[model samples]
Structures are given as C-alpha cells and as structure tokens.
Target: MAFEPLKGLRVLDLTSVVVGPVCTARLALYGAEIIKLESPEGDLMRGLGGQSPTGRHSGTYLHLNRAKRNICCNLKLPDARKIIARLLETCDIVVANMRPQALARLGLDHETVTRAYPGTIYCLITGYGLDGPYSGFPTYDSVIQAAAGIPGLVAARDGEPRYVPMVMCDHVVGEIAASSIMAALVERSNTGKGTFIEVPMFETMANFVMQEHLAQHSFVPPVGPAGDQRLLSADNRPVRTKDGWIAFTVNTDKQVQAFLDATGKGDLKADPRFATVRARADNVRAWFAL
Candidate 1:
C-alpha cells in the first residue's frame, strides 16, 4: 500500500514564502490537510519567484503550495481573530516562517499557540533562532548562503564569491523543517503531548557547511586550516571529454581504481599519492588533476 501516515491531520500553514511552504508541502504530500493562511497582499513568492501565465501563481509558488488549501486573512484587523481562532481549533499542527515579532503580534507564536492549544504541534522556521543576536533580522536565500559560508567556500575554490544560482538555503532549511515536524509528531504520539520545534536557517546551514569543511580545524588546537582541501581544489570539477563535459566523483579505493582504469590511467593506481583515500586526501590537487 502507498504510505500516507499523516492522513487526516490538519496543518495550519502560517507562512508566506519558500521555507514555510516547503515544510507544509511535504506534510501535504504525506496526506495532511494543509491550510495555507496568507495575508491580503498574498505570498511574496507569487510575484518574486518568476513570471507565471496567470500572473498570480509563479512556478515556484505553485510547486511549493501544491496539495494545500489557502485562506486570505488580514490578521491586523480585529475581525480576523475569529477566523484564526477557528482554524487553530481544527488544526493539528501549525507551521510558520514569519519573523518572531510578527507571529507574536498575531498571537501565532509558539508560546501563544501552544498555550491556547496544548495538543497542537508548532514548528517555527526562522532565519535565525529567537535567542540569537541576528534574531528577527530580514533574510533571504542569498543572505543565508553568505552568512553560512557557501559563497566563501566558492571563493576559496574559485577566488571569487558567488551566490548559488537558486534558493538552495530555503529548500534545504524547508526540508529540514519538515523532518523536524515529523519527528515532533512521532514524539507527540508517544507522549500524548505536543511539541514546539524551531528550525533556524542560518544555524542549520552553518552546521551543514562545517560538517564537511571543518576538516582538521575541528580538533581543539587547530592542526590545519578549516575547509576541505579536496573540495576547495579548483580542479575538483567537471572534466572535458571529447564529446562534451563529464562530472563524476570517485571517493572509495575501488571506485578510484575503476575510474583510473576506465580513463586509461590505471598505472596511476600504483602511485603513492593516489593509491588510497588518505593518500588522495594528502595530495588533493594532484589527484583531482587526474
């Protein structure tokens, strides 16, 4: 049978753009009823994501909001409180990505919502965590990419910083937020209690970058510089073949050996610098040049 574990669950999506929509979209895919609440002006992505045939539903907006229902409410008006209250009563989960202050003002922040609906699972996706110095600061994918050292990594490899050509930070953080919400659901099922989950984009992406690039600097007394030398190598990119360009990665010994053999450089397998993982790591530039 097709798995749909979240069937019948109602999600109140108090989000506007990519990150929060990404989370609710995943829940919707798992059979949750996503109630996407938007302001009168509508989601920024509707216009910012790109041109659309309808001039209202941009491709990015439509893709992220699929399998969901939408409600337009201007929470700033007192009359809209009733609608929010009614939705809160029926919703099993609330996922939001607005700034903390704005959510708090609308009485949709974790504290207010959890206090009113103790059984509701609340997930807040923030550009920065509530307690951080950068908390409540406005941010987007490119800003986050810069804050999380993505462009810096590129600059290390190519000598120039550049934002990734897509909203990678939002997609990654959104998926992570979805995973966190699912985990909270599991915990609630066991404990008979709801949970408050916070997914921060800057911290999450920073941790992601560090997991691979911290390298020897992870040691207490830094033995070497941060950043993975292999990843930072300029030659660690697509190779030119006669027909076109080919991009491939060979990390394991067997894969490396096979790659060398297939490329008619099998004799390099005997070379001390490319014989094993450790050797290759120690001689990244030379290994990548091959």
Candidate 2:
C-alpha cells in the first residue's frame, strides 16, 4: 500500500478551472478526501480538451480531477449555501480560484470562510494580487505567460513573441499553492489556528522568470543587463550533429575547458576572453561563435 500522508484530512475544493483543481488534485493524491464543488452545468474543463465517451468528462478534466468526489451546487440558492456551510464545518481546507469579486459575492472569500469556520485553512488563487490595478482582472494561462515576460523572452530568441505552448503558469502556481497549503496545514497542526493564503499567478510567474533572467540587474547600478546572455543567445539551442542533435550547456570554467578539449580546441581555454566566468559572460556571443 502507498503512504497516505493526509489520510483523514478533508478539502472543500471550490475551484473549477486549472489552478485550483491542480492544487486539490495533488492533495487528493496525498490521501486527502477532496470534495470538488461544481455547478449544475459542471466545470468548464469537463467540456474542454476534446470529447469524452460520455461527452461530459474531457481528458484534461478527468486527469485533473481524478481521485476526488464531485458535487454539484448552485451557490445562489440558500439550500446549496447551507450545504456548503455544512461541508466547510468539517473540511480542513477550502480552496478557490475564482475572481475576487465573484468569491466575495458568493460569500466564499477568505474573510468570510475563516470567520465562519475557525481553524479552516482558506487558500485563494488569483490572476493578480488582491489590491492592484490588475486585481480581479480575468486571466488565463496564456495571458499570464505574456504578462510575466515569457513571450518576450521567446521573442528574444525566436524573433516573435510566442506563448510557451503549455499552461506553464497554471501548473507552476498550482503546485506552489499546494505547497503553501501544506505549510499552512502544518502551522495549523501546531497552533490550532486557521490561515489565509493568496497565490497570485502574475506575481508568482514574474518571480519565476526573474529568478534566472534577472542576472546582473539583480544588483543596484546594474552590473550588466537584465537577461542572462548565455540563455538568450540564439545559438544556445541543441547543436546539430551529422546524424542527430545533442543538447548541452557549458556554464562553468571547467565545463567550458572540458568542452574545448573535447572539440580539439583546448588552446581556446587559455584565451583571456574565455578564461573566467565573468569574461565568458561578457564575451558570450564571441564564445558561441567560436
């Protein structure tokens, strides 16, 4: 049998789309009992990602919502609200990825849930932070990718601003939210207190991008430029060989020396421009040309 870390925990998953569902799916996998709250019409993802045999459960939806119980509710109805309240009373955690205003209107916001169900961990996932110009703005994976400079980075390499061809922001933020929820649960276990966590897609994705691309711009009076030149280099892709292609990275001085020796250009290792990390970073284009 597999280990069930969350064997007795219950999660009221009020999120319908990718981010929240992804988070709860992970929790469910860890043995939490997940009640996936949907509407009378069902989640939008249920109809997305192509047709199913029953035409109700799309592959994407099925994969994202596996190992969970589904419940249909109309939050506008008083009876449904009572049912949600009852579920909230017993659940250890509640997660939602709806618009802030929509969540507030439905009385599912963090403030309302934390007050009503003391000690219940409330996790809210949003496109942007709660109080900003873009707060409450509708967003999807592609929009977040563009906003977080993904397309721009792609443009730097490919000459055209293109999405990363995947729902990267949703997946990354969802996992992050899952980790945050786990941390909150641990804290609750120790203190017997509830916690409210907000996972904002835009800010999270921005930090993700900058962690690598910030480069010298991470310092005041910028040492060089914002982006890592080696990563942004057009020649940084897989090298084409006679029969196939091989992908490799030469980051450290020793690795560069080894690559040079392997290519029978070991003499280049002694070159002043390629001798040190700083020098190589400064002359990355010339080094790539070599």
Candidate 3:
C-alpha cells in the first residue's frame, strides 16, 4: 500500500494555468481527491506546450494535470454556481487562481466561500493582492518576473534585461502555495477552523529576489545600497578549468584558506581584503580577480 497522507481529503480546484493547477497536482500526488474544474472551452494550457496525438491535451497540460479528474462547467451560468455550492459542502479545500474580481463575481472569493462552508480551506492565488493599484491587473509568469525586478537582476549580470526561459515565478509561487495549504490543513486539525490564504505572485517574487539582494539597504540608514555586490558581479559564474569548467564557492575563512592553498595563492590569505567575509564583500571584484 502507498503512503497516502491526504487520502480522505477532497479538493475542488478551480484554478487554471500554472500556479493553481500545479499546487493541486502536488496535493493529488499526496492522495487528495482533486476535482479540476474547467471552463467549457477547457484550460488554455490544453493548447500550449505542443499537441498530443489526439490534439486534445497539450504536453504541458498532461504533465501538470496528472492524477486529477477534470470537469467542465460554464461559470457564467447560474446552474454552475449551484454545482459549486454543492461541491463546497463536502470539499476540504477550495483552490483558485482567478483574478479577485472574477472570483467575487462567481461567488468563490475567500469570504464568500468561507461563509458558505466554514471548514473549507480557501486558497486564492492572484497576480497581485486583492487591493491596491494592481489588484485586478492581468498577470502572467513573465509579467510577474519583470515586475518583481528579476529582469533587472539579469540586466545587472548580463547588461540586458531578459525573462528566464522557464516560468520560474509560477513554479516558485505554486510550490509555496502548496506548502502553505498543507500548513493550513495542519492548523485546522488543531483549531477545527479553516483559513483563507492569499498567495500573491508579485509580492512573493519580490520578496524572494530582494531577500538576498537587499544587502546594505536593509539597514535603517542604508549602509551602502541595495543589491549584493558579489551577486551583481559579471564574473560571478563558473570558472573555466584547464579541461572544462567548474563551479565553487569559498565562504568561510577555513574554506577560503583551503581554496587559496590549493590554488597556490596561499600568500593572498595574508591580505586584509581577503581575510574575512565582510572584507571580501567590501572588495568583491578584487577578491574575484584574485
């Protein structure tokens, strides 16, 4: 027998595209019963990432939606709302990635769903938070990456702004939302109450990038500036060896000394700038050149 942690849990997944579906797919792998609610026209991803032999399910859709049952419903119709209400009565969780207004219009927003079914964990994944200027603005992986300053980071490294080839923002946010849902379920076990979770792609990705890059700007008066110098250095990549290339890092004093000795640069360990973490960070380019 398989270890099915969520074997008895039921999830009504009204999420399309990468973020929401990816989250539910992970839950389904843990043995949750996922009912993937789709529109009559089907998920847009069904036409994306190459066609199948039958031309019905795209490769991307097949991979992301495995181990889940799909159902088609026209959310614009009143009958569909009735069907959703019936599902909510028995579901342990409800996940959606629609814009806040669209969810509100369909009576599937966190407040509305919690009101109807007090014990359902309502997870709403949005491009932005429910309020503020960009709340209702449409967003995708590339848009979120650009808005979160990822392209700027790339520009700093390569002298040009570029979207990462993969849907990095979507994948990161989806995995985070999945873990958050599991945490919520654990909390509900103790409190006997469900929670409303809002995972905003813009804010989440911004925090993800800035945590390492904030560097000196994290201080009250701003010690120097935002962005870690070492990370922004154009030379911060794999070094070419005689045969090929290798990636390595020497952070601590012991590691640095070992690296310097191995590279026949043991004399450089005596240099003040190469002696400590703070000193090396203060003169990162020189340290890299060394």
Candidate 4:
C-alpha cells in the first residue's frame, strides 16, 4: 500500500527556486495533483547547472519537483493570465512566490482570487512578510540568514559572524509554509470557505529563533547568550578521530559519566565544578576541553 493523505487535491504551484517549490513538493509527495506553472523560458532552476544542453535535470531541481507536471506559460501576457484565471476557477489551491506588489499588479493576489473563486485556497510565499517595513524589499537564503542573526549566533567564539551554510533558512521556511497551508485547509473544511495565507521566510525564521533559541535571552538580565544549547557550541561539528571523524555527543550526566568511565575519567564526575547542569554550563569550555 502507498502513503498519500492529500490525494485528489489539486495544487497549482507557481513557485520557482528552492523555498516555494519545496513547500509544494511536500504536497505533491502526499499524492496531490501538483500542476507546476512555469514561465515561457521555464523555471530558471532548469538551466542552473550541469553539462547537459537542456540542463533540465538539475539535481537540486529534481530533488523538489519530482511529482509535479511541467507547464510553460508566459504569465506576462494577457493570454496567459486568462489561462490562469480559467484554471483557478476550478482549481482547489493556488500557491505562488511572487512579491506582494507584483502579485497585485498581475491580479493574482489573494483578494482577487477570493472574489473570483471563493472556494480556492491561495497561498503566497515571500522573502519578507506581506506587511511590515521590509515587505517589498528583495531577499534570498543567505540574505535572510544575515538579517535574522542566525549567522552571528553560529559564529566562532572569538571570530567574525559565520553563516550556517546550505541555505537552511529558506529550507526551514519552506517546511513551515507547507504545514501552514495544510492547517489552513483544515479550517476551510470546517467553515466551507476559502482562505489566503502569506508566508514570509524571514518572519518565520525570526519566530523560530525566538521559540527555540531566544527563550532564555528574551529578558533584560540575559540568562545566557542567544543561541541553541547544543549546536551553537564552538566545537559542535564532526570530531577528529585517529583516522577520520566521528560526530559524538554525551549530553546528559549519565551519558557523560559513561564516556568518562570508558575513558577512565569517571572520578571527575564527582568534582565540584562538574557536579550539576548549571555547573556544567558554567564550565562548558573546561568540560569540552576535558
């Protein structure tokens, strides 16, 4: 048997690049009929890399757009707009990543879609949120990382701010957008009305930082630095072994004692500084050095 919950759901995906496409791809994997609408030149990701002439098989693109149907349309033209309006008339969901103003100019925004098709669920993904000061300003993964202070949080202890590499900001935002859409769908089911959602990558990541890492530092006295309890450690990456690497962690006192016993250093567990969680936190550098 196959696992697909969103079967029979029609998702019209007008997203390009990593963030937006990743969200719709999740829907596709759940057996939704994902109609990926591309521009006449096709999604720029098609020609992003590789030695092939068409460059249609970008590993990055293939990773996200596997179950979607490719459809090319010149959205700048009136004929293309007409075609989309017709499709939206019957489609259950419409997802796009265009900027807020640009979406309004094209008459493809949530308000327009709601008036035309009251039962359609329209979701828009943006670099920043739909409102606020930096709403219209352009942004990408790295830019969002810098703006969100994630890079600074992950930086070296005594070195300059460092980025968390791999465009994870966009990646996380995509997941949040997908989950938000599904939640909205659930509400629509109960109320028998359509819904509109605006998912801003920066806004989402900002909240993520607040909930996961900023909890302790949200006060003025400053319980501690604004960072993850584990990953933000200066030496949190792969550990060097006699041969290669082994990423290992002994988090709790019991696990720490296990490693200490194996290494014949269990006696240190009873020392004053290594006594409790607060002590361990206070002397983390010495603990890590040991």
- Compare the candidates by TM-score and give the number of the best one: 1
CA lDDT, every prediction? 0.89, 0.90, 0.91, 0.81
Candidate 4 Cα outliers beyond 4 Å, as residue runs: 51-54, 156-158, 211-215
Which tens-of-lDDT digit does each residue in 1-290 have in candidate 2? 98789889999999987888999999998999999999999999988888788888899999899999999999999999999999998999999998989988989899999998889999999999899799899899999998899988888877999999878999999999999999999999899999999999999999999955688888998998778788788888888889999988888888998999999998887899999998988899888876
Q: 1-290 in candidate 1: lDDT tens per residue?
A: 75789999999998877888988898998899999988889998888767787788788889989999999999998889889999999998999888999888878889999999999999998888998689898788899999998998889889999997888999899999999989998999999889899999999999878855688889999777788888889998898889999989999999998999998998888999999898888888898887
Cα-based RMSD of the predictions, in order?
1.5, 1.9, 2.1, 2.0
- Model 1, residue 95: distance off in Å is 0.7
Over 34-76, each residue of candidate 4 has an lDDT whose tens digit, in order, gives: 9999877777677665624565567778887889988888888
Per the 3 Å backbone cut-off, how many clashing residue pairs does candidate 2 have?
0
13 Cα displacement, candidate 2 (Å)? 0.7
* Tens-digit per-residue lDDT, 1-290, candidate 3: 88789999999999998988889999998999999999989999999978999999899999899999888999899998899889889999999998888888888888999997889899999888888988888799999999988888888778999998999999999988999999999999999999999999999898889855688899989998678888888888899989999999989999999999999999998999999998998999888876
Between candidates 1 and 4, name the one with more favorable lDDT: 1
From the highest TM-score down, the ranking of the candidates is 1, 4, 2, 3
Clashes of 3: 0
As a whole number from 0 to 100, the lDDT of residue 194 in candidate 2 is 93
**Distance (Å) between predicted and true CA of 280, model 1?**
1.1
What's the CA RMSD of model 1 in angstroms? Answer: 1.5
